[model samples]
Target: MISLKKNEKWFWSGVVFIEMILFYSSSMTYKQQTSVPFLERYLRNKPLAGSLKHFGFNYGGKYQSIENDGYFHFVEFFVRKGAHFGTYLALGVLLCLALYTYFQKNNFLKILVPWLMATGLAAFDEFHQGLTGGRTPSVVDVILDSAGAFTGTLLVVVIVYFILRHKNMKKT
Candidate 1:
């Protein structure tokens, strides 16, 4: 078991709480006119659809194809997935930092513990979404969330390693 100092405990707890609030808010369905109209208006004029089509990227589906009325939907889908990735990335960072602060002796534990916690939270978020009125759970989303967590954790490890190395060099 790892014991955190008072300030460290408060900071990590705040991060976890913010992540939970973000997940809860995202579980709600956004009405089309609320924000989609604004995004659609912007994307329709940006040539983004044409650019994607030029790259041979086909957003295939009955309602999500590039040749049909799916351009906005395609863009929106990526935007939503990007949000999932980014949010999980932040969660991963906080978890990794918390674990590192308490378990500084084990490199493996730092990575493994944060990864497991973030992945579990992702699964729980998906399940919660499924219970919402218009949201459906997806295994692919869980995978994406896990990948984001891994990337974030790896980034933190690299950053901390370099910082520690620099500090040691300065000490000599």
Candidate 2:
């Protein structure tokens, strides 16, 4: 596990957030053969090894195949490509991060802030892809993006409950 510094939660969360969006972006950005070298490069790097292994664990085991026959399809007409499950995993983490950050924020607006922020980020990414020579934006991608934000937000609330419960127990 990567040692997370107390102040690095946002950074890690942003990384996950961007990567989740990039999942579909990269699919639109490159052909299958072209994407393999990058994955190879990532796998050979040590810091990424743990993440790589985890991806495989989530993907397949023992015999690692280059072909990602997993539920998330890399090929899509637009940026909304891939399995909804990948979105679930990443959004779950990001939401946990948001909820942690919002615990003491105390305004009802605090609840909407993360959702809006994620929506804007996802929208911007799709817009960026649309401007790119090879890609175009899709309403489906926007919807999926919102779905990811929703999933993330839900995760945060659940985690906060556990954290608070644990804290209460400790104090008792």
Q: Which candidate number maximizes lDDT?
A: 1
Cα-based lDDT at residue 7, candidate 1:
54
Report the lDDT tens digits of candidate 1 across residue range 1-108.
Answer: 233443567658866795777676657865621345767777667566667654324222224445554567656667877887887888888888777776688877
lDDT of 1: 0.73
**Per-residue alpha-carbon lDDT of model 2 for 41-152, expressed as tens digits?**
6544434333433443222123332244322222221123344335543654564454545455553443455666666666776677677666657666666767777666
Q: How displaced is residue 154 in candidate 2, in Å? A: 1.6
Judge candidate 1 at residue 87 and give its lDDT.
79
In candidate 2, which residue ranges exceed 4 Å CA deviation? 1-5, 9-13, 16-80, 83-92, 95-99, 102-110
Give residue 33's error in model 2 in angstroms. 8.1
What range of 10 consecutive residues in model 1 has the weakest lDDT sum?
Answer: 55-64
Q: How high is the lDDT of residue 97 in model 1?
A: 77
